[model samples]
Target: MQIVSTLRGLMLGLGISLAGAAAPAQAEMLDLEKDELKFGFIKLTDMAPLAIAYEKGYFEDEGLFVTLEPQANWKVLLDGVITGQLDGAHMLAGQPLAATIGFGTQAHIITPFSMDLNGNGITVSNEVWEMMKSHIPHENGKPVHPIKADALKPVIEKFRAEGKPFNMGMVFPVSTHNYELRYWLAAGGIHPGFYSEDNITGQIQAEALLSVTPPPQMPATLEAGTISGYCVGEPWNQQAVFKGIGVPVITDFEIWKNNPEKVFGITKEFADQYPNTTLAITKALIRAAKWLDENDNANRREAVEILARSQYVGADAEVIANSMTGTFEYEKGDKRAVPDFNVFYRYYATYPYLSDAVWYLTQMRRWGQITEHKSDDWYLDVAREVYRPDIYLEAARLVVEDGNAAEADFPWESDGFRAPQREFIDGITFDGRQPNAYLELFPIGLKGSQKIAQNAVVGG
Candidate 1:
């Protein structure tokens, strides 16, 4: 375990002087409803916010006691939140959007906090890496960073020529891992098929087959040659580097800068029933986020330790810190500094932007997961429902009012984002308000109410 002393200093320094301010006369005292709470998370490093909040006493400081539990799968985790077995969980940015639209399991779940950005990587087996290495251009015999998927194009073709299907793994269908992997492959001119609800064809006609593999089993699955490569969250991708079984080709930050990854999700009913508790939890999370990003990520090493405990992420501190401590390992012994790789606090990481929600909706429409096309207004309405910026603002206001945070720490005048972001590997600039125009930019997706049946010639 990498116990960074500097991180301790950073967290302690930023620790809020909540003792100074009294509960305001006008402020509503947080109704102490459901003081003891259970939250769920998959065993991924980005769940750091929840772990850090508990470990650093942030939760208790907000007059809330919380227990964190590891969930078996994404579906199970979502179900727990819906049924109130768990108040919330670390979730895919797409999960709430998918559920609200009746895609898989319809539920009215929403999020106010986006956990972090850009903490995923694509890794290939050592044998496959060697094959891919031949095509990649190098500078001074060192493999390039942000390696494109073009190099793997020929490898997949070779497997197809030999009558073998090229298979890859992602955490889940609606997961950021799946989309990031698809985006990387497609940007390199490799077609990663599509899904139409009406079409029973499980095959999306992808050039390289994509499937789901549990995070802990990713390395084993790759070692068994079941999957040539995979897109997954930390410690898993970093685990491959430690085992020397694989080399990470690209990080998601390289694919799309500052892409939204996970969210702290809760049902709308839960929020309405316990609004004060809701704000209290959000307050604790805000403090934890501050601790993580304070002093330019000096607290990450300590956070990695807390996440390593058996009750939380339960991974080795070294494994967790490999990516958590502002660096990532690709090939064995090839460690590089990637400061924003596992961001928890900076760049308003705690703020859940409506544009982030819209982006995920656009991806769903792009891939035919959303069977019908809707107008820009519809997109905004859905985004507004799921991504609660108003609630977040309220929480931030309370923390600031309580002297737990400075007024200068937040974006008081944030216009969601400065401009249309154009950093994607495909170079597509996405404007959140213009979903229809964005849909028109894609070459391989449905747009303008284009139905799957219309594209098929029955007798051909």
Candidate 2:
């Protein structure tokens, strides 16, 4: 009778141990400075991390009740973040830097986490695609991908000969799309224009004139023939292919592999005043990003369904699934496998590296939006001011301690820069430490003591 009683106790102890091992560790919920919070996002598929966090209970796990609102446009979203109407928003990687530099609206904003990577594509209208088909190389009856703007050059020339302005659209003046489109166009011997203080049109000395159009309107605008082609985020790009109006010729992932995209931006004043709340929000976002990419994107199909809801992306589940499910559709019926098209956590996508900030600043300078020659150290200083890796690592540490994230997942020893990157479409290498020297590699853009004056590049 004594032996039987002892065996029963041992069995109970073993069961409890097994259950504890299987359960995920929960981090101690911080005392949030302000528990109920409001966040904003543009209606795009890359905003999935925000939606997933709210839906999958990551935000609730951190004892945060977050209200995710969709703003009308990027400008309104940035303004909301600035005016404290919104706690923080999903922001363009350039919005904070541009705001600090006083490009449009002057406000000091900072980002603690990068939202995702490589979720944009460049699409051209059907007429433009038809015109360029002969110029592009064909493989297995499909157009050769990473389609250079060189293929569209003759179309522009024909328009120029016929006295028609060749206009293309980008989401904003200081956007990754603007820079990537310019890079791809310039690489293919087409000028996508420049920005000058005197002329904010960004059409100085250009073969293809570029202008601004909001993301959701990209497809309708292209269909209406307001612009020939546009560069924007998904599933708008996929929306075009679905509507049979435009063809996505190239994705930003092909242009620049693993390029950083959106960010979770907040005011520095907000961070300083409510540090604990900031950490809590970042922790929830980090966990959401991990779930988006966990088990090799096992959760993406579910994510696509959530993002398809009206309050989030509001696009069809099928359209969102195209890129969200590790495949991308270029031309209609030309779906191809692109596994890294929407990277959330893999490759340290959430870590807001200072070097990534420097790259955007350099693009601003290269395109004359900065309007002054900034020193390399100036670039680093601005980067450190806006990109807060310290806050990110702190939040990451909390996640790690909870056993929710692996220690090897975060870059603990990084000096906040990736090694020099050389996978550009033009085959030029960019070292963040030498912003000016890196700018000089581009044959087309302004570099070193150069400024735009009177609708022309002057004083290099």
Candidate 3:
């Protein structure tokens, strides 16, 4: 791969004169504040950018000797970063925000890089799927795509009639899976519940109860009847299909098209102390992200192999490839083309957009994880504090200077927010600039000055 990169660099150098383009400037190696670094990630395929950066020599190219450690779970991963055990980790988009605002653990965490987009799916056990099949529409004897949470609504009601709680699993409270699962459920008129100051279980006034389960444990937990369904990142969702234990009813892509997923999170203290190291790390990750999506994902098969190794995601290559290589499996033998299922780059996936940060904050507020109503300016300020687009754009500039990426490949002129997105499953447009108004659009969840008090929503 290094040889190929060198050859490609040489060819580009030769082509510059022929094409009458000015020669690309060589990027100077950053003066190291820290050279040897350790990063952590949960065992999910969205961690691919970190793994690819390490495996493809992008980290070494930036003079970084990186150790990519697989963490036990999201909390352990976040704690590792906060305590300086790991420099950073692939994090849930809301982790840094929740931490900064003192939700669970109070620490000032920040992310300069957004890892990937739309890499999660909500899966239900075989029993639950069998029950839901009748409610779901079909075409050509297969269930229609983007199967809404309405299909699960009747099933949850049935469970209620049977005097049982309809339990579901998400990776963490602040995880994209949690918000995506809740969003999908609420869109179909099933309340996934809320989190209050006293009750952090996030099951207040709920139809389906959501709890944290580690990503790798999702399939087993579902099979054990501990959770009827789960929302998690690959290859666990694909793993369930491989084991015939569950069916993935929907991908987060269908819930919110191209929604921002994971971010590479580090403490503010670390970034402040090792500014050059932060830029260097971001540059390498940017290159890795570009490679993952380059040539229409021509390198995905290779990426699957790397992720399937024991030290990485450790799932079967075929299972990892089920979604990583531009398709996703919903039910057994129901494989379909979903080209954007796991986006590492393209669509500015790596840029830490403030709007993306604001979207997560909105979800945090909607779900009661945030106890008080915050103004729109508060949302923007929190996003600015946590999502460092300045660092990300600087790294992008350096990567472009190094001839490792095209200037066109980045949102160099972006104002750090995406244009208001409207591709949600429920058809509600999200204007990040007006978060409170967006909150008002939701039927379920906290809005305005509403707060969960004594087991009910009040003060709206």
Top lDDT: which candidate number? 3
Clashes of each: 0, 0, 0
Name the runs in model 2 displaced over 4 angstroms. 1-25
Q: Estimate the Cα RMSD of every predicted model relative to the unseen true structure.
A: 5.6, 8.3, 5.6
Off by over 4 Å in 3: 1-26
> Candidate 1 vs candidate 2: which has greater lDDT?
2
Q: Per-model C-alpha lDDT, please? A: 0.82, 0.89, 0.90
- Tens-digit per-residue lDDT, 1-460, candidate 2: 0001132245466775322221245755676688668899989998988988888777767766678889988999999999999999999999999998889999999999999999999999999999999999998899887788889999999999999999899998888899989989999989877888878888889899999999999999999999999999999999999999999999999899899999999999999989999998999899999999999999999999998888888899999999999999988999999999999999999999898999999988888898888889999999999999999999999989987899999999998999999888878888889999999988898998889888778886
Model 2 Cα shift for residue 176 (angstroms): 1.2
- Cα displacement (Å) at residue 21, model 2: 22
My TM-score estimates for the predictions, one after another, are: 0.91, 0.94, 0.94
Could you tell me which 10 consecutive residues in candidate 1 have the lowest summed lDDT?
A: 1-10
**Alpha-carbon runs more than 4 Å astray in model 1:** 1-29, 199-202, 415-418, 454-460
Task: Output the better candidate (1/3) by TM-score.
Answer: 3
